[model samples]
Target: MTTHPAETVHDALREEPCEDAWWMPGPDGFAACALSSSARTVAEARRFTRATLEGWRLCSSVAEDAALVVSELVSNALRYGAGGGGKEPAAVCPAWLALTRQDGTVLCAVSDAGTTAPVVKVPDHLAESGRGLHIVDQLSDAWGWTPPDRSGKTVWATVSSVRV
Candidate 1:
């Protein structure tokens, strides 16, 4: 974990074996943690999102929504944001989950080592999978994916809970 002032959240992760998990309270209202592109990271990411939001004194609704978004984003990253053309090994494919607060909103983003974009699929009750992005769409006020950089792409969602 690193809290370097100028470094972006993606810099906090490296494509190496995730021997241990770590978290960082980054500069300017940002916090991030390192994760591996594995199924287990979904639970871990949701937990981290809740903890970070609590630490930031955010509302429960925002925390809940953010946690769900974090789970979907991390799951997508692990499932789709992996493999092919220099993508790191699955066991150690580095991923990062980040949160940043701006007034009444919290931004949840997951960055991974794959360049593919996230697509929202039509809901099919019969299918066991392919509903992650739809959940993200329903929960987040706004969500989208960033184009791939040298390392990979980032999918982000925002949840706003401004009380009167």
Candidate 2:
């Protein structure tokens, strides 16, 4: 985790990531963390996303939605991605959570070794699963997944800086 100077929540939310108000090739407004496929992953991803957004001066504006979306994405990855069936070794199931700010949008992406594409399922009210993508769809401006390559596939969602 990167530590930045403390600023007022309002000021931070209104501020952009870089000095010239543009994203460079580096960590101008990007943060990422590895996640384990355990019960604590959802909470860890939420904390990491919220903190990174706060450091980027976007917490007050989109933190709630971003955190929720991050949890959903990470949960799906843990449950369905490679090594998710509780049999594979952790080394074979590497996963990561990434955050980036670009052109007034915050992008949250989760990458995992699993090759299965994510799908949105319609479940009954009492069903315990299959609603992750639904919540992500409702909260994000846009969401999609990339096909798995040698490294793995990534599922991403975008949230506008300005609230809807």
What would the per-residue lDDT of candidate 2 be over residues 1-164, giving only the tens digit for each residue? Answer: 22336542322433332221111122478776666555555876786677777667765658889999999998888777846334454354357788899756899998887777898898667988888899999889999999876556899999987656
- Backbone clash total for model 1 is 0
TM-score of candidate 2 versus the correct structure, residues matched by position: 0.75
Per-residue CA lDDT of candidate 1, range 72-119, in tens?
888888777755245444346467788999977998988887777777
TM-score of each: 0.80, 0.75
Clash totals in order: 0, 0
Candidate 2 stretches greater than 4 Å from native = 1-27, 59-61, 84-93
lDDT at position 135, candidate 2: 92
The TM-score obtained by model 1 is 0.80
- Candidate with best lDDT: 1
Query: Clash pairs of candidate 1?
Result: none
The local distance difference test score of model 2 is: 0.72
